[model samples]
Target: MRRFTRPKVIPLLAKKPPSQLPHLSPIPNPSLPQPPQNPSPPSPILTLSHTQNHTHLLTFIKTHIKNPPLTPKTLLHFLKSKLHHHPTFTHLDFHVFNWASTVDSYRHDHSTFEWMVCSLANTARFSELGCLLSFIVANPCPCSDGIFSCPRTEPIFRFAISAYCRVGRLDDAVRAFDSMRKLIDGKASVVVYNILINGFVKCGEHDKALWFYERMVRDRVKGDVFTFNILISSYCRNSQFGLALELFKDMRGKGCSPNVVSFNTLIKGFFREGKFEDGIEMAYEMIEFGCEFSSVTCEILVDGLCREGQVEEACELLIDFSRKGVVPRGYDYYGLVEVLCRKGNSERALEVVDELWRMRNVPSLIACTTLVEGLRRSARIDEALEVMGRMLEVDMVPDIVTFNCLLQDLCNLGRTEEADNLSLLSSTKGLELDATAYTILASGYSREGKKKEGKVVVDEMLDMGFIPDLATYNRLANG
Candidate 1:
């Protein structure tokens, strides 16, 4: 079967209209509020342009009408499939929709109304969207004429309301919501109320969000967990921790289970209030409630406690969490290690790394590097070497600069053979060895008077394409 390809649309200014295969038109029209009926006459240029657009639309529609009378579905298909993608014609969607409304025979259904609403909304055309909403409100979907309201009407306005809220047009969003509630058969869904509340919250209108929440309750609408979460976070943001606590309790009484977000919010609120114990206590409560700990939860706990100079407590908490296997594997615990090392407590940092590593919670490369540098600074070479080996086994290699520094340390202490082994291991483990790495090892072998080993190191450097100069290579290689 041959595939049919849509022809490129002709430019609006082009005199010659393109030859058309088949296209589209409309069926019925709904009278709507455009400009006043007895308005000023159009200019000749706009008149000509309008006539050309109308002629183009009519030509396409007449050619492509599959059934006898074009329905809203067919019209919508033409809008999306044909005109919507066109550069010049795309902006004329509303005009074409108006043209459809002019057709006395075809009445639009929800499909057409929703398409236009979403199209206007997605383009951030609020002024035009407001007019479209007025049109939708004045001409309710035919389905609303039945006993039950149009199920789709609320969703369309819901989308529009969200769009309005996104642009901080809270007033317009409320107006749209009120209009939607009137059109729908019953109370609006809790989700619509939540959107309005969230919109207010996002605009820093916490009081308004609360007022709206009260209105929702009085309207006999029930908020789900998501609704409670939004309000809870808003309360915390407003510095109403006491009220936030009360609302949290009410949430439990209402059988809305607090998720990780709920806990994280309150925990952060506690930290802000300088209630360290309370913050940590609530984290423990999260465990009791069987809520999975999020990475943010750990951050709040670690950062909060450490900020208050309770670094050891933070360390204990992380280790405890790891023992219970409750720690997120992706968490590196680098912050705690850095804090510990910064406080001149590298001993504790070492223990923390060792304990966590033994529990199979792998340290990130930075964590391993940090821990290694801390140990080396405190001259704990044995422990640093142990950590390095374990990290290399897991394919967690540090950058070459760090490896070279550690090699220099080991070689200065007469452990060049071990440094040589480390260099070899890091190379095989994907850490590219620079000339300095082999030079350090070569110098160490020279100091130890191991000419065979020194020459061997020089030979390995040559094989790896790292020759400094013939004289330098000869002096070191002959040593």
Candidate 2:
């Protein structure tokens, strides 16, 4: 026992070697504050996401809602208040609706679903629309008492398909149309097919539109005027005028009378195909059918004839139809007037304007402005001033651009006094003078060697925060 003790004492006496000591981490700074063992919960994330839709919806409802227990009426009001006019933030409404579907406390009513679909469709959120439709189809509203049915479900699908066609998503539109048939209570309305046909036509898939029309006919859905019109327009756009005329005849045979739009489409098609005579014939035919000319019909006739260098014919047609009360009021006769003015026939332009004025169809400001510009260009300054006076008497003040033209003409002719008087008169008449007016006056003064007047105008410009360029300032300084 003594020998063993001596042997151990030889190692223990050296005081454990440095390598034999236990390794330990360095101690943290005692002056620094220690982190909390349990930190406060993170602030709720303010995010718009599908996964967090329920949480966000609850948060929004708590902030904006007022009723103790949410009812359809109160929820609808809350939704409309937030979503009705705010087109950009409509996704929040969808999120709320989605969250509402999960709750048994309330159910979405018919009006709510209709409004949501309309809002989504109108805003062109077709992808969201598709998802919404799927949700409605899969999980019908609880208000129906376990019946997964909606009266307006077909209409909503129809709108989505129509919108899809408008944006060139033909496949999605067709899929929606197909899905609609299974959901609708009765046979799909012709309006639904008409929408698809029109969409195909608008997207330039003319053959596909025609094919879809055939499918509608085969499906035994009674084609209406809208259905025939879509086909006619599509045929016309594809330059298949023969097919368009045939469809027009078929529309009549089927007892579906053509309206102003139908005739206008054919007439425009005729003009597009360089068949002006055919277009004119179509107009008379429209009258025989008791269809009054729409504004579009008048524009087509007048603008088409004018473009074909038959301004005189177009003018005569306009006057004749206007007197007969066939064309709508406010038809643009100025197109013909502008054409005459461009031909340096200001006399004819003035005559047309007077004729319209006598009929109590006062010319637009653009009409007066155009005539004044024409007169000025032809060096007929006196006539231009006369026209300007007429505009004022009619309470149609000249725009700044027209006023500036007159001022420039006067200054160029060394009539600075007249220009200055006109400026004062314009301001009195409520035409706010801009910096250009003052600069024009100053330039005129400088040109006429009126140094005092020029200096005063420049100082006014400077006081108004309009610093002239270096060259302009040097000229003003010299003046």
Candidate 3:
């Protein structure tokens, strides 16, 4: 975490080591091609003071390695260790790395520079990070000499751009992006632009992202599907549906077919803008375009329409589309089913579940619970019991709330014996009764003045830590 300070120059009377070591001939000059070799272990370092002079540093490397003709691998290993172990002396690492790069026998590879940039970025040392990047831009790595140059440059700048943008240093990110452009062989690819566009959008610089997209278009860099998707998603987020639609159309005109995500975004936007019908129409259009429906499309259509109080329309659209094989199978329609039951149309809801069941679509646990509660609320206790039976048959266990509702409803109707029987039935079905279920039965017994039966229920409730209210105690006492 320490800032970079210029190391004071110390004069040395020792003779300067040859920039090219004299004795070793096995190590290929980096200026010439060399077959790859395994990297060697680092030289032991006792202090940073010995490394300030390139002469002493080169001699130190020559003398310390156990076995090496001093290949780039060995030199990189040595330098990386110093940087890794002695982070406080990173200022010296830059110099040692530069000196090693100057040696014809060893040049810094992409990994070396990348490690340096990553270290500087990770440490939040932006001043050194910028200087190192500038150095990379000016003096391309020796391996990046000819045909191999542009490809290697991409990752370095891409990493730099991502790192810079992550810290909210948008200006530095842009500079790195510009440097990346100058290094590529042909027109900058959509991928590089996508990185910058995504970074700008992530930083909430949407206008800047659009501006960069415009620049990309003007520069004749063709946008890909990802490019279109990012922009459309951004436009949709900024409430610029008009612009989003325009871009969607523009992408198609450019022979870039809209994908499912494109359709989903625009459709969701349509719903958000209160254009539910338009959103549905868009879903149909997507199907006609051979773009498959995703789970999100189903959610948007069903949730959007139901929220607008057109639950029946939403359900019908799904069933109708599903029958035609337009909407993808296996989309969770439980929410829609629950919404229907909640709207007091439990009979119609049950019918819908039957239809789906006939088509081999099993009801979800929530759908079963919703139906049970809805039937009880409608005073159709027999139908509620039938739904509960169906739930048990399907292995869809009812939750405590569902059990409580059925028991409370039975108790409310002066059917204490039936409620007690139902409680026993739920236990046989693995639906454990909670304190609320016992209290409901106990209260029901007290109301009927069945002192023996009621006293047993109250004792059971008390055993389960169910403290009855004073009213219930008085009723028991009076009974």
Best by lDDT: 1
Per-candidate local distance difference test: 0.81, 0.73, 0.73
Candidate 2 lDDT at 181 equals 72
Question: Which residue ranges in model 1 land beyond 4 Å of their true spot?
Answer: 1-68
Clashes in model 1: which pairs? Answer: 23-64, 24-60, 24-61, 25-61, 27-106, 28-106, 29-101, 29-103, 30-101
Residue 405 lDDT in candidate 3 = 82
C-alpha RMSD of each candidate structure in angstroms: 8.3, 19.4, 11.0
Q: Model 3, 292-316: lDDT tens per residue?
A: 8887888999989988889889878
True-vs-predicted CA distance for residue 378, candidate 1, Å = 1.5
For 1-479, candidate 1 gives per-residue lDDT tens digits of 21133222221121222233222232222353355445653311111144455567666656666464558888999888987887767876776666566454456779998998899899887877887787677667777665677789989999999999998999999999999977787789999999999999999999999999999999999888888888988988888898998889999999889999999999999999998889889989999899999889999999889988899899899999888878877877898888887777788998988888888878788988888888888888888888888889999888888789899999999999999999889879999898899889999998888889989999988888888679877977976
Of the candidates numbered 1 and 2, which has the greater TM-score value? Answer: 1
Q: Residue 169 in model 3: shift from native, Å?
A: 3.1
lDDT head-to-head 1 vs 2, winner: 1
lDDT of 3: 0.73
Predictions ranked by TM-score, top down?
1, 3, 2
Query: How would you encode candidate 2's per-residue C-alpha lDDT over 1-479 as one tens digit per residue?
Result: 01111111111011222332211112234466756655754211122534344444455567776544556677688788865555544556765555444343344656666777777788787766777766555444443333344566776777787778878899988888877776555578888888888888888888898899889878888899998888888888778898899999989999999998899999999999888888988898888778988879988998999899988878777776656658666666667778888999887778677766667667778888899888888888777877777777777788998888888888888777678777777777778778888778888887888878778778877777676576766666565
lDDT score for residue 240 of model 2: 89
The segments of candidate 2 whose C-alpha lies over 4 angstroms from its true place after superposition are 1-135, 138-149, 376-386, 400-479
Give the lDDT of residue 337 in candidate 3.
73
